[model samples]
Target: MISRRLGSIAIGLALLGGTGANALLAPSAEADATTSRTYESLKNGSFEADAGWSSFAQGAGTEAAVSDLRASHGQRSLRIVDSSSSSAVGWASNAIRVDPGKQYTATALSYVASGHAPLLYLKFYDSAGRELDSTATSASTQRGEWRAFPAVSAWAPDGATHAQVVIYSLSNRTGTFFVDAVDLAPGANASLTANQYFHVQNDGSATPWGWYELDDARQAGSVVPDPTDAANGVLAIRPHVSTGDEWSGAVGTRFSASEAARYSLSMKALRQRGTPVMHAALRYYDRHGEVIGTDRSGIDVVPGRWQESSLTSLAPSGTVEAELIIGCTGTVRCDTLVDDVTVTPHWDTTFYAAPSALGSADGSTPESAADYRDDAFWQEVDAALETGTARVVLTDGQYDVATDDDALHLRGIGSDDHRLLVSGESRFGVVLTQRADLTTYVVQVRDVVNLTVENIHLTADGTYVTPSAFLITEDPTAGERTEGIIVRGISLTDMPGVKYSGVGVAGTVPSGPGVVDVVVDDGLFARGGSGAGYHHVYATRGATTVRVSESVLQDSAGTYVKLRDNVGDWVIEDNIFVSSGTWINNVQFIQWALYNTTEPGNEFFSPGPYRIAGNVFEAQEGWCAPQCRVMTLTARGYNPVDHDGVEWDHLLDPVKREILMDESEGNIETRRAVVRQNFNLALDDAHGISVTDNEYRNIDTLMTLWNTSDYGAPSQGGNGVYDLSNLFATYRDGL
Candidate 1:
């Protein structure tokens, strides 16, 4: 026998979207396609309960029990109080069952007694009787009123065909539990939308998104959301500029689109004050986050209004996934509001041509495109050269030249994209030389003044005995000054056993300060014979103000870059010199001298100012050779003895012999040289030279003054002695 007590009650109802109070019914098994239902219930007193279920009060004995309610007219009254007892306890014999592989929502009409709270506990079990998940509802009201208690739970079934749903009381206090109009059913379809809700702030304090912003703008915002709703939200951004700041921002949209699909994006922007520059960019990234496709366009925005900008281009090859970024960068103070973002995919119909090949200029020659003498293509270039407006493009391939005086020349024309491949073993490679003194090769332009020379290979089979593989000469008699000459992105190699210099650029006297602003970037100069004795690449007289940066000069017998007396204001930066036989013993790697100036009177006179910074001079581990000197200033030709009766001002201070040893101050001596911050020298062998402020790191001996000539003893004023700051030594070691 069991008895139940009366508990507390609370009631409230929320109308969903002004719908009627039509209760939802349990969905039928055949209604599995759509999990939604509606129903209505009538009030009745014919409550019903199955046999073997019992209820009782906690203080009452088992004999005193409550009776089960019976159903009448399809309705029943779930009595809260069968007896006026302190606490109610109830139990059912059989477990409630549910179907597997389905989700159900259960609700009950329940109320509790006054001063007694009632909580609903729901326990779910698998078909194998294992508990999956359990939850409890909040305490109901203690008022004496009937209320609808809607409790819903979702369950996923395993392999079992049946599951149990147990509903029980969680509190041990005295209360009445009334339940009626119970219903269980499945849930509806689940779908999600894509929206850009996240913000990316560009504060200009770090790299990445922040770095993309203008220096003046404090920050920018971006958002990323689910892909489904990606087409819904507007990517709105504001580009603001202060008095001393720049405005910039980049917004990137990531997606996986078809490789062959042509996509375009259009943006509408509103500007506030100054002229605004906005750019729309499309970029594709692979799984490794490498850029595979990129298209960009920009528009200027007028003050006080809105403007529209659009960019369209063919997606890069093999781009399966890509990111579309809109960037705003400029000094104008303006706000750009973007909207109406859309992506339309189309089929591509454009044809792609493979890169052109490199060959010789002789017609009717039976040779491969890579061969130096493929006359068909060379004739095309020669014809274009005659017009002075043809572009000769050489793709990355090997070309062999098999003639003595068969030179490759582009004279008095606007030719571009000339590439000479000079790497790897070959039966014979091309030798590109200037046949006429007035000829010049025009490479691609970079950074407004620099030019690009694609790979140039100068290889020769073991038979031909040539003096030089490639040469550029300017005759003073002709009075020609080749201005804006740049040789970048070319690999030049001299074949083994070549006696002459591999490449030479020589200028004759007085074409008015001759070749100016010559640059060589990203090139490899390797393998020349010792008999050349000058340079793998030599810049002779009148080649002024040259820069050799970002190149590797290795495995050469002579100097890498040699500039004579006429070359001034030269810069050799960020270059790697490895396995070179020996530099010019007479002149330093960088030299300055006043030609024909007498010593004593011309001691302070320097031929030119050359800055040799950020270069690495390394010796191969077991190679025994003298370490390279930074610079050698020669006063040999212009000494006081050679001049007439005029005494040269001693630039070398007799009082500061240690500082005057290398005369490094002369390089920066006049304060005209900008040697503020740089790494200049490093050598394995320690010669007795005082390397002043150029910091040396991890060196065993910081500064050694070798006693070649007994200028003094090992003391402060002694010439052979060395005084070094530990700070200078530690700094050099780190480098």
Candidate 2:
């Protein structure tokens, strides 16, 4: 007798003769037309029967058999016990026929009771039964816990028609392991999403359902009944630690995860005893089982109280597996209880905005585009940014942005794991313009990360001199600093005037942290108010890893780039810094006043290893009348004479000057920098700069240090500029 099954329906064939001869059978036309064909290539994959598998033991004291002792799934598993220290032992599945040039993935669940981990492999064979190639996962070493083999995928080699699923113990191990629920299917496996939320049952068993000791060899613990609910249970862990390592006592569950996808984890934790802190966290691993990133929940678990902790994270690049870990830190003796763990993925959404669209106002599509003037539309955007991902798409039109506060207040939004993007239909078509004269910035972003603003034009009323076109600041309640900000393909301009034009794009170190990882690329920052306070790109203090490249910084009332105090690891390259008639003073293109401040808590200043290369500095003829310098580097008291004859309202008086010059240095020394491979066109001499490998056109005396008699030189080892070899690569490496 023979049997054939196609998708849940089976057909049986029986011979009418008594001789037991072979016979040909065909399906009826009606049956063939209505049914589809499928194949279960790997027979008895669940290890319910031992018929489709072959086992072997090549060394002394090795054993392999189908056992009902323990299993990851179903009621039975293939058990392999190895006491042999020099030979391999395990089971191999019957050959599963495969097509050449097609990819396949083999997945299985394994539980190691005591010993080294077993390795899973997919071995391919050619048409002649010769072995071709194989792919294997590293030994998964989370002992006494059930773990999925890191998925192994391979393409069938040329002339190959079959493959085998192999589970074997390494040559030098002495332990017992079980393999169950093995599968071999075409294509790679999908990320697991079904068993995200787990609840303990009445019998004190969880998913993959087993009660065992904690993974750490020294830790002694188990699954116990929940104190609050007698019907349910919780994972109870007690750390056995000789050191106070954060991961000293941890239990983890691994799942398949996609790279760059966002996930959130939440669980209820209770600290019962000891002085250690209890935490719920996640660790991401790559294909080779190396940990790539770890994110810990910020909520603290207090003793005797069940507190829920939540965390959101983005899987790093190249991540293949993610582990949810509950652990105790800071002490050797601690008891922690965890229950009701949930993991969720945050999906992405796209929003549309236009001038006249009004269908439902959901921002889901062009027909349902959000009205730009609707406060509810912006509110919805802000809400999406907090929890998940959002992309704002704007149509080509003028947007009237007139408000007393910032027009767009991106406050307490986004995170390092998820980013927000605002983009226009075209680079120069969408305009964000101020309708009324306001003193604040057009767009103010406070304590946001991974935000990108691009492909728009930002401007103010011709009469209103706003403080800044775009500003970045910190809100301590949200984060420590604003980071991962990008301003690309934008045109930002301040009100035009010599006396009081504001900055184009500015970052201020208010009372908290400053900005970092800021990139201004392929943009225009121009038309600023004159004086020492206004600039195209300005940072008062604490601007770390700020880069300005492939942009135009032109027609500034003050210097183009001004960085003061505690700035380092900066790059200014591939830019055009041109001074027009609006630039009246003899201001330089770049200014670095590396000064220290006594702002109570923030004091230290770092002498940066800086890089200024591959830029062009040009000035219009007869412009910058008094003098023109390419760049300036100085400390606070070094240029006191520049303020010697200042009038009232100069922001600095003689008494304040004396106090500033008399302040303590705090014993911080400045590090010199390199300015290389630049082009200076018709500009006056430079001060305190080491110009190297630069080209000059109609400019005399390009390399000039500050004179002590004429301009008050910087103190030795203080904000002095010089050239060094291979500085760009060095500074980039440090960043």
Candidate 3:
């Protein structure tokens, strides 16, 4: 269903990282594995205090102050009101000391009611309080409503120190923009040593967060928190620049200052995303304040790469104190961060997330205003879709599909907590029933490039009249067809109260600039009653690849997956199918290839040279009637109804009213495929087919090579039966 849902299966890429909670914590020497940790460094950064900050505003209005105005998170946010009549003007903050090379993040929450007017940026300064460079957030505010802006970033330079955070309006744009929660800090942990690794250890040591900047061997830079680069925003040490010392960069605290015969050190460093020519140095000092060793090791890396550097050096006999120092020197003016610096006597090689910043533990989630089946729910869904790429999660419950036009539309779902959006202990929610008579499909994906839907379950309202729960159809107006789609971690079961089980087609894609890959993995599709294409998955549009693996199918009509045109594919392996129905196949591939229904004969698209292996096919012995064939390949150009007068054609009524399915013809050689390494005794019969290395049991037919060309005949091999991937390894014992 390239026009509808047929296409290649493309995996929706992973979502972004979790909040600070998702950040890594440095590992403790005593623990067997790395642990997660978080720390707060902002000093009155919440705008709750008036003494720590100097606020001002400029432009036509020329007014700014910390007020009890609408807050972004906590109470009392900073409000900047400007006028359009005046020239561009703004306010600035007093300089905060920072060490060169130690990367610091500057972050602030901003809100603009109108167009992309006022912009917020950061300014860095050296020892004498001279300006060094200006940096900005990843993207500028667009003309929109009130919402939070992305985190801004910056890195300090060597000889360069001190920074002033500022906000202002450029020409042609002047409006009210609010700023709150300004935070600055290092982005990660670069190494692990004696210093408690990012303040995460509770090993009876104070977190050496306090750092000092030195010019000519004396302390110089003032310390403040950098808020922009850390997730959303966090606190950091801002050391003053001392041009006097090439090493006048920011310096971290001394954990386990008591020296040893040998010392090993490591830490992570980075600058802005694309800045070039940046460097950092790690130094070691002996007792009596004497320099013993310094690592001028060349740091050749791109910005924001978080490159880790390690060095081991032997100390003098009298080494009483050791100071691990970090300095930055780069021709490129970009914001940098230094995190997870470690000094250890023992060299332990390993990788770990930054223990300093929080990782995936903010514990905040999008609050649901309404259930997923309501108009309010669709409105929320529509808003997320507008972002081009969005992350959405459906909580557990039974939802409804009213009118056919009201199917749920999806674009993208974020990475973290997509499944955790549930309130308590529910697997997923499903569209159970339809409110309107015109409603056929429960979910119809129209036009999108790459999409992923996972960790969700579908349930019916127990209404027997309901057709399918999910369907992807053609949109004549959409020039861009879907390329890749992944549907995983889903489940559909018979309802407790319903009379006739709900029947659903699950999904389909259109034909045009057809589909590339459609993957259905790790799901359960059971008893979607006895309708047409109402089993697991059915695709019409020709897909370059179609994959279904690691799933379970039970209590459904005979046919399971009917996705044709899966060219050159991985095995449809590791599945369990227990059915009692007397159908031609548990798996079938037919050429319904309809490129453009409005057109005549469409070009032939090869479905697959598929490898169907590693599965357990059990046609329950008690259900009666003739045993169903495990695999069937037909070269038919039209939908079939088992020739017998008894077997009904459930697809006729639905297709007749919708698309012109009768007008399209497919390639006669669409029956090409392979089946091997399966435990099923029932062999499929078709042209250009290969069924080999399988076990035969209480079944009739072994191979039925009937019509079609380019098929691989089944090869004979092993006779033992086993399930795929040991999903059923201990299954019988559990039973």
| C-alpha lDDT values of all predictions | 0.38, 0.56, 0.40
Q: Candidate 1 on 350-434: residue-level lDDT in tens?
A: 1111122324322222232333333444445434433222223343332334333234432332222221111222111222322
Per-prediction TM-score to the true structure, in the order listed: 0.42, 0.43, 0.37
Per-residue CA lDDT of model 3 for 694-723, tens digit only, reads 221122222222222112312122111111
Candidate 2: Cα lDDT at 75: 47
Best lDDT among the predictions, by candidate number: 2
Worst 10 residues of 2 by lDDT: 15-24
Better of 2 and 3 by TM-score: 2
Superposed model 2: Cα runs more than 4 Å off: 1-347, 355-357, 371-379, 382-388, 477-480, 497-510, 581-583, 594-605, 638-735
Ranking of all predicted structures according to lDDT, beginning with the best and ending with the worst: 2, 3, 1
lDDT of 2 by residue, 1-735 (tens): 111111221111110001111000211221001111111245445554323455544467888877789865434688888988877786666566665445678888888888888878787765455567677775467788778888788866545557777777767777888887676876632213222222332233332222224454522244444455433245566656635455544444466554555777777778887654666667799746898998776456689777887777887755658876666656457677766566665557678888656688788887789876566776777677666666788887777676754266666666555567778865445677776766666667777777777777676666465676677767655545677777776666554532322223334555556677677776656566656666778765656667777666666767678766556556676565655444455547777653322212132233344556545455544555544555554433332211133111112334433332331333111112111101111111132222332212112122222212113332333232222211222222222
Residue 721 alpha-carbon offset, candidate 2, angstroms: 13
Root-mean-square deviation (CA) per prediction? 31.3, 25.2, 26.0
